[model samples]
Target chain A: MDAATPQLRVKRLRAVLQSVRPFSSPKIELEQYHTAADLAARILLLAQSHGDVAGRTVVDLGCGTAMLAIAARACGAGVVIGVDTDADALADAASNLRALEMEDGVDLVHSEVGSFCRSVAKRPRPAGVHTVITNPPFGTRTAGADVAFLEAAAALQPQVIYSLHKTSTRAFLLGRAEEMGYHAEAVAEMAFPLPKAYAFHRKSEGSVAVDLLRLTREPPAAATAAAAAAAGE
Target chain B: MRLVTQNLLTCQVKACMDTAATPDGGFLSYPLKVVPDAGGLKQVASPFDEGVAKSILPRLDWAALRKTAAELGVAALPEEVPAGAESDAGFLRSVYALVFDIHLEEGNLLCPHCGRAYPVRKGVPNMLLRDDEM
Candidate 1:
């Protein structure tokens, strides 16, 4: 049982994350879609491989049921904050933490993502949000909900943000990321399981194509330097 | 929430963000005071990772940490982050304790500016604002 291997680690992580309780009542309006444990392990492992998770301050925006938050903490994120608009989901997150015996492992905040960003922006210290990992609402129900989460993460000015979005919106989200000072790269594609939880969901079991996007904050100096180089050329 | 998280949280009330002046002339939303209930505080022993502590040290608001520590009855922190504090194990341990160790399981995070109280139950602070507050 050599956990040093990434494969073994992911297996263990997925097993632990599986213990997390899902939403008792999924909110369609909020797009309370759960990120499966296997997928969450893969994402967190990838982030850890890239020096993003371990000992980094990670914020989980719209952290429904805190699946990703728990994963991040388990993967050695120095500080993990799970912010969500829903109280019931946060209650579940708390129980998940206690169940995992990680009662103090993650911090849970109850706030809309937009306001949470605004409030954190006013901290006396410069922004300390190092990385943000979120499986935001795909905005299927509420128009622009996905982009709203992106905007909130960008406002924190973290070094990197990893978000899941419908693959169909790749071009549009890439454009938005550019406009928001991030260099967006679609890192991985996943078939996100859409377990039939809503009345509108027709299929008993279904999946959707999603892209895992890594939005790196382009350093202002580098951007300026590149622009200068382009101008000189 | 741990002080590490608290160090980053401010009052999210929309009116508070309008930059209303407090008596001391600080922005109303800058620091939300911690009001811990009796026997609400818990100190958990977490592994001290030097890398994490160093990365977070510079980003911390020392004044806010000091104020919160005083409220929680922790020992006084130095007025400033000592020179070369990153390599100072003792200093880092203290910082880790203040930031990551202390948890308010049940309490209220009262906003200094708007006098709004966000309740903390089961160690999760509810920062959700009402429509009127928003």
Candidate 2:
């Protein structure tokens, strides 16, 4: 028999795979798209490292199976929404949320990223919404896909935006964000393990570099002041 | 131990770099999003090595990264490989620094062949393809 993987999450994952009954047959088809332990730690890091997640409106772009959003809720985000284009994934996401007993803490959206971003940008965040988090795709190359996403994220100029991508992608990300008018900062990053017999990842994942970022928009003192004055009336 | 660093070290896909394009660069596919199994989460990727980054630096499509880098307001790197620094570990460190240290908080990885853009939100890259692209 193959030697057992020693990683804690790996061992834990193997157990889950063998035990968890499927909602209606396992959604194994979407297994390749779920978030693993390492990334979960990263999301936790983003929540804890930043002080508090309480009362923040989090829009999880490309939410895949809503794992991150659920984690965000557990970490104390006031509200969370999982957005994706896969209908089945959305259904699975809803089921997952129900399983976590966090269905009330989360919402699901079935839509494309760009259209979603566009719609959200057109309106102010409901009541207390504030942050947007995503793990966008970094196609075969490192920089191209991320550069475009960063540009779009900056357009809305949210106070904070967190994105995960390959290590081979920082220069373009930072440089592009600057050109687009937001100050980009690499806040916290951690490596996640990649197991074999999976899609997208082919190697025995050990420590491939993945980066996390915190992006802040430029100051709008003048606009803020005007808006405040108008509100005072 | 950035997840981004972990990926470039082990992504050994043959012909992985952007070939025939003016510049060549390796793909960094780690930092993936996975779902929680009853035991652990799925979709997470492996980490990379500092050593492989050095070996791969010279081969990176500098022209392409530079072009993309410039759009982000970074200084333009020379189109061709500069002399005297090919074998320098520091230079490779510079390459690793660029590839792994920066973050694309709100962006998408666009498909070079199809022009399809994948969204990157909250430090995660959504590299999913539409039914047609797949």
- Top candidate, metric lDDT: 1
For all predictions in the order shown, the interface RMSD in Å is: 1.9, 18.6
lDDT of each: 0.85, 0.49
Alpha carbon deviation, residue B40, candidate 2 (Å) = 34
Would you list the clashing residue pairs of candidate 1? none
Provide the lDDT at A36 for model 1: 94
Q: Can you tell me which runs of candidate 1 are displaced by over 4 Å?
A: A1-3, A219-233, B20-26
lDDT by residue for model 2 (A113-143), tens: 5544543343222112356777665544433
Please compute DockQ, using alpha carbons, for every candidate against the native two-chain complex: 0.71, 0.01
Give lDDT tens digits, candidate 1, residues A79-130: 8999999988888888888899877878999888989997787654467788
Best by TM-score: 1
